[model samples]
Target chain A: MHSSTFNFERPIPAQPWRGVAVLVIVIILFAAAAWEVRCRAVGYGPTLNDTEDLWAQARRRVEPGSVVIVGDSRAWFDSDLDELERGLGSRPVQLAQPGSCAYPVLEDLANDENFHGTIICSIVPRMFFAPGGPLVENARKAVKRYHTQTLAQRASHRLAVPLEEHVAFLKERDLTTEALLKELPIPNRPGALVPPRPPPYFQSVDRERRARMTESCANPGRLQTRVKTGWSRLFTPPPPPRYIPKEAFEQRIAQAIEARFRDTTAAVEKLRRRGGKVVFVRFPVSGELKAFEDQSTPRTGIWDRLIRDSAAPGIYFEDFPELASFTCPEWSHLSAGDSVEFTRRLVPHLRTALGM
Target chain B: MLGFFKYGNFLLENFQWVLARGGITYKPPHLDVFLPIGISFYTFHSLSYTLDIYRGVMGPTRSLRDFALAVSFFPQLVAGPIVRAGDFLPQLEAPPKPQNDRFLWGLVLMTLGLFEKVVLADTMLAGSADSVFGYAGPLIALDSWLGVIAFAGQIFFDFAGYSTCAIGAALCLGFHLKDNFRFPYAAIGFSDFWRRRHISLSTFLRDYLYIPLGGNRSGAARAMINLIIVMFIGGLWHGAAWTFVVWGLLHGSYLVIERLLKAFVRPTTWTESLGVKLLIGLATYAAVCLAWVFFRASDFTVATRLLRGMFGGHAQADAILSTREILQIGIVTLGMFIVQWSLRETSLEAAVARLPRSVVTAAWAFMAGALILTQGNSNAFIYFQF
Candidate 1:
């Protein structure tokens, strides 16, 4: 059907325009290459230069049978690898970054042939109830990577897809890239360690109110005062609603987490056929972080349901309300000392949970 | 009408808030300035329809389907040639029978439009125009002029490319649409330019605004005032900002002046002299760029800074143009201008027909190849916001 018609127009006379088009194409190709090389030489690709390269190198040389902290930013900052090794006799690799949401981690584990032992994931309450929640980002990134690979392969072969398909693929790639890029990274460092710059004018009043509330929440007698202050704070709208309340937001997050857990567990069961243990741990959080979760008023039984429904056994969940009691000079993040204390308490629980 | 209501309600609410907060001055949000998706294009089409109907040149569409299809045809849904209902409804009623040759030609046209947009406009924008326009610090006088010229070329190609895509898409769906542009940069005067560029939109204004406001018939001053009113409103139709309004006023003022000048100093030659052509083009181009300052900038402060820099406020010229960017800008502008100029005497369909069959076949192949190779990273059509 494709080769039915041949244009027998004067034996296809040598067209000067074709030569011009060829010349133009060649020049464009050379120019593009030069521009790319120049951009790379000047380090333009990633915002944080050499960050990915560092990860790639770290991935290659990690010692076998070492503890692995596999999660997002909380895992990156909260888990003290040296302290864990000192206490548990194994140094852990912190295989996580700021914006590494749950699904990618699960996909990575599913694809890994050598992944064994425990995998700790941090499931923050706010993450579950955030607009443009994690599921969208996961689906977007997966589709983007798929489309990019497809286009790159087609280009290499000097082949083209149909215009409609090409447009569809490009649109998907764009939507995915946009969503992923806009996904704000959870700040990893402790506030005291980072020492955030003075609040902008828009944030000054809100910051003061939050600080006062935190200070009040620390005192038992001032709990009533803090509650009054929180209600009064709502009377005066602070820096846009920090979190908008929508059932869809929470549902999206829950679905995303459940999907990740189910997929990861199924993959792990396949590996278990060859005799490998798979233990899933929900990482510990600071007291203030736990307080945020308490405020969230999570739909009762969703977390328990997810854990119970998982295909794999050895699922350990940590709900450390005491972590919030520590004087970690941040709304959510734990101090280094608090992180060490939490890990010391968590390691034994994980060991028992994994039957190690 | 619903678009107007939505925009008006949004603006009024924002304006009221700004007024209520007496002590603190407030800038309107970005959403305030952006036109609803298809407002500018569709409103122009609506205005054209009413005018055509009133003029007894075309009847009102008999069925809502015909009128709706005429207005909301997906291909030209965002940007447009402002397809008149008179010309469009017949085609919608009895959609053209799709022939293989027509389909192939439509494909070729669509490919060409994509090439013009993605390869030419997108690359030039990413490489040079964006940076040059965005330059905050000092710029040489020559650099400013160059920037303006580049912008003129960019807007022309961008808009014309969009129109081509709309028309080509319509053709592919077995419908005929009117041409929006006709090598407008080659025009010698404001009137000539209007005649050639966005023909439907200009005609709409002529029929609805200018004529209603005592167009040309009233004495010179009143006529000028009428012209200014039309253009200013036209500009506001593009955006909800003072900049767009000012841009429109500037063009309207120029048209008035150009008309008066033509009346007093009539050229003896049928063709305008090369010097006159160059002078008019340069003058008009510069005027357009000055107006674009308002179009591009966030506020008057940024526009002022850009204008000052353009006029050699700092006199920095060391890194104005990179060699590669210059080549790209040169090739795209020269290639497009030459093709447009050559096709001035012929319809695009006729021009394609004139080519040898092999050349025609190869041109389609080449266009397809180009579209595939450089289909950029899916930037939204600029007019979509408007």
Candidate 2:
């Protein structure tokens, strides 16, 4: 038989507890205040981090016949919600995520039997046709969060909005401990396969998941240069992994891309069968990033194949002089001013594509 | 029902494998089951109560409300210190008088826990561990070792953080929960490791399974078998995967080997020296890390690949971890070792008591500040799955 009766009280360290508490609070407050001021001085502002919760919030707003935007950051950045609302007769639900594949969101909508509305999917070919990696993972994560978010998580996100809206240093993507640590100037081994750090925050996101390029990023400056420089590295495809044979890896990638094309065509067809409309749009890219992306994932490749396979109406930025004229300040996304104009000009083409 | 959720697919897959070996092909219908969060912990909480009552250690509580409260004490309900019903029921017997000191101390502990989780585990180690583990290419030995080491630190902080937070939260509610971890990385032997690490699970297994199976009383061989059986069950308790089972079996094997060594080797002044203990502790940590490869890996393929890389099988492989990641792992692991070594013989409360009030305040402030910087981006507690 077990011996002892259960009686255990945790020992609370005897100290001047009140003094310690007060002092700790004071120090934390001072440190936080100093950090906030420093962040603001360095061009950081009170902007909500585009979290999975925020993505889920936007996803939940999608009604049966709602005009939904599903794609990568181009769709997120360039499309003005206000302009789209005015043009499309309904405000499109912004489901597009930065650095994420559009396929998952497209697939999710296809699977949603109730959703028979129009989908304006932005085509960043590399991201759109990504087989598996962070690009696909990010979109899948947002979609998963929409499905699996708990009441506690929903509540936490709701509470965080006010604080995130007011606090400049609450930038989860950049100013977090992990992000700051990544900013440290440490050299890697020559052959190290480390991924490049993501570009720092250059845009502000609103409650509706609308992202607008900040003035610091939009104008020709340090932030703009830094953001532009980071893109070519990110856009260029990673080298084939050493573990797999080169031919085998290439063949696997080819197969995956083919599968994606077939799957996308089927998804678009499914939506169309249910009285839904789908249009693929290739958003404008600029500078070195555009060159790298064009070289890697050319229009003759995934984009043309997708439009042909899906038989969805396609809008290529380069095909139209008006849309192609506006330059992306940072080479990847549109500035706040240009985006509104871009969205305004693009609305008529969208109307024609969807036959609205 | 809980077991079905956790083990349904695992069992089916294994069964299919077994059938294939017998030259029969079978395709079982897949069961899509959602694993209830903290299913393992709460099951133990309820199981311990029934067993305790069955064993005449404690009487069955008449009040269903009190029993329900003990079973689902929110703080420890999901990821636990696995608070026993016998311990908790008695605490609930008397209403606790809330004290300012205890509540503030609890808040301090909670801050420390969050700091460990957010800043240390998620920020410093998880990326490196994840990058190395998730890489599709062969990795150099340095990357392999760093990856495992990163995982070791990450799991410790992640789990220990949750336990500390649970204990602190319970304390805030005027209840006491026992410590789950006690500088486990400083343990000098497998026996010592179990004694310090996951104390609740270890004790629960010892009391319910090991002793009942003729623990050390019968004979050396029988005791060894019992230890392995208990650890096998312990490993299975963690997850449905064979990797977890392997992890458990590795620990069980380590325990048996230690027992055999103990039978031959005698303790002396030289053996008990600080340097020797430290060396042994490092070896114990290394072996534990090897086992953790199995625990953390997705499958045997990943485990074997990592193990081979660690042993320099991939001589010409590319280095996957960046210099920053390597430094982060090195600094965090070293800091952890120092803290664990210093506090091996004491409790956190006792250690804090010895510090100057100013020093305590500064440490608290530093942890809180770092936590604020983290902005709560850390993943959920590792043990919540278990």
Candidate 3:
């Protein structure tokens, strides 16, 4: 009975489709990862942009003998590097963006291996109160999520390690190129032009009037101001413009500047162990703008306190009220004539401050 | 149990105001939290399984490993079609051999889900949904209607995408799961729609609550009372909020009225015609929209403000129906309805399998690419709160 038929039968094998599909998915993921790595290697990521490029270029190009003039927009547009060189016996390199403060400039100097020269950080209280400063918040959050070693921690570990432990420590943690890249002073593109050639140099009142006329015609708001020509137009007047009180506007601006300054300081300190000096400066303001600053007494008091407390062995210059007569064309910034004069005046003081 | 304590601790600490307002006795520092991701959904599934076993409808699982695997199965772990133990366990016991056709089809289904979530839902939300929902003043009738339609589409696509992905993943592992939705918007009545939408959860509620509370045994009044109780609990299940409770109660009331009307006023041939069906569908959809205001809003106050706006409490009617909003709503609504209608007969897996291999592969690649491009900022699922 057991030997009946004695026929051999084969069982169908299970298909490997699931394994194949998984393989395909793995390949796709690998391809994506490879592409992302390639992109990053070429300096293509969300954080790498024109600003970073400019900073990187400047960091590499600047030499030990270079005199660097550093501040916010005032330092960029207010002080002429050529005039400083002509006045002082050395050429000054302008390292400034429109709304940058002292901390970034200091961090740049400390981080750059090639930069071994004098740094003049312009401390503009108004610049300290500029907007958009929570730059490191997301980076911090990402670091926290990914458990990446911070620069401070890495530096501490490296400093603590003996010569024999160096290779092992280096093997344990990947060096952050971002940290190195951020040591450079990134330049921002020039901001929108402020209309009305800013009340031309105080000496030339008639020149100011001509500039105002040109501005009035060119500016949208000034152009919108209608002449009382027709009865119909007078009867059907346009709605009053939505107005923000000057005080409120200044308060918001001040808050933004303070926040940015604090954030930039934190970022600088994070990168400071790499051996960078930090500075904060206040650029000169015109007499009319000085009046506005004086009117904002509380903010001014706070600004003074912030400057005094932020002593990082760097310059905290208030070129305002002192240099107001020499350079300022408008409420805050300098005219071309004023910029040249101000640069000439700043050279000796900067050299003395930087110990060059 | 640890997850329960963690959630309990969180609630005790964060929502003392809610308890204080309700005059509920509770104390913080007496709670703990061991938050497992998607603890809410998993707990509900566990409860459903335990209750079913208790009722003698399903036997208790002998193996803890099987139970744990079923509960924590990654595809449906975060969000789900709420797979039942009875339906899911048998497949695990005797795993089917994976077929090439099935694997390809699963890929197709996954892609379709991604398309619904990223392309349709995310784009629609970025356009009109955010603006309309966030509008402060009373909505014009047209704007309110558009917002409701947009929301309906959003919720369907979002949940359906999750469900399809879950099913596809399960299929890949040689298991079959139930469909969670079946063209719910196309349903003629509230009852029909409920049957189609979140079917597993709805069935669980019916079996656990309605039947235990004597259901329709006593009278219409008792039945109404039972419905209200069930719905209130359902709402509470969604979140620790009065708004959700109220939303549930409102839906319960609607269902009761519908049932009562059905018993008392039998429809004639004409009344049961296409026009009548259309009217009923629109009325049911409108009611669902009203409830969603409460569901989506942070609290009852916000929901009331939104309702008032919808009824033209503040703004002129013309101000509500902006051309851009209408166009955005129209596009989303069309896309949602098309997908829903197409996936009605066959399961998403089956439908994809029917397509030519080349088309299926291309469709999947395109969907995967789109998902990557337009990924939502949110990593958490909407239903994770429940």
Candidate 3: stretches off by over 4 Å: A1-356, B1-34, B126-148, B315-326, B339-366, B375-379
Candidates 1 and 2 compared by lDDT, better number: 2
Which digits, one per residue and each the tens of the lDDT, describe model 1 over residues B190-213?
A: 777777777767877887789988
State which candidate has the highest TM-score.
Answer: 2
Clashing pairs in 2: none
Tell me, by DockQ, which candidate is best: 2
Candidate 1 vs 2: which has more TM-score: 2
Which CAPRI level is candidate 1?
A: incorrect
- TM per candidate, chain B: 0.86, 0.98, 0.85
Q: Write the residue-wise lDDT of candidate 3 on A1-356 in tens digits.
A: 11112122112123343554565576557645664566445323321111222333343445755656555555665666666677656766555544354445555454555555555566554344434332222222322332343465445433433321222111111112212222234332223111111111111111001111122222333221221111122122122212345677667667766666566555445434444444344556545445555564334464556544554434333543445455343344555566667666666665564444
Q: In model 2, where do residues sit more than 4 Å from their true spots?
A: A1-4
- Candidate lDDT (C-alpha), each: 0.55, 0.91, 0.55
State the displacement of the C-alpha of residue A205, model 2, in Å, after optimal TM-score superposition. 1.2
Model 1 whole-model lDDT (C-alpha atoms): 0.55
Candidate 1: segments with Cα more than 4 A from true spot: A1-356, B2-6, B13-37, B50-57, B315-321
Output the better candidate (1/2) by DockQ. 2
Per-model i-RMS in Å? 16.9, 3.1, 15.7
**Candidates ranked, most accurate by lDDT first:** 2, 3, 1
**Error in Å for residue A203 of model 3:** 42
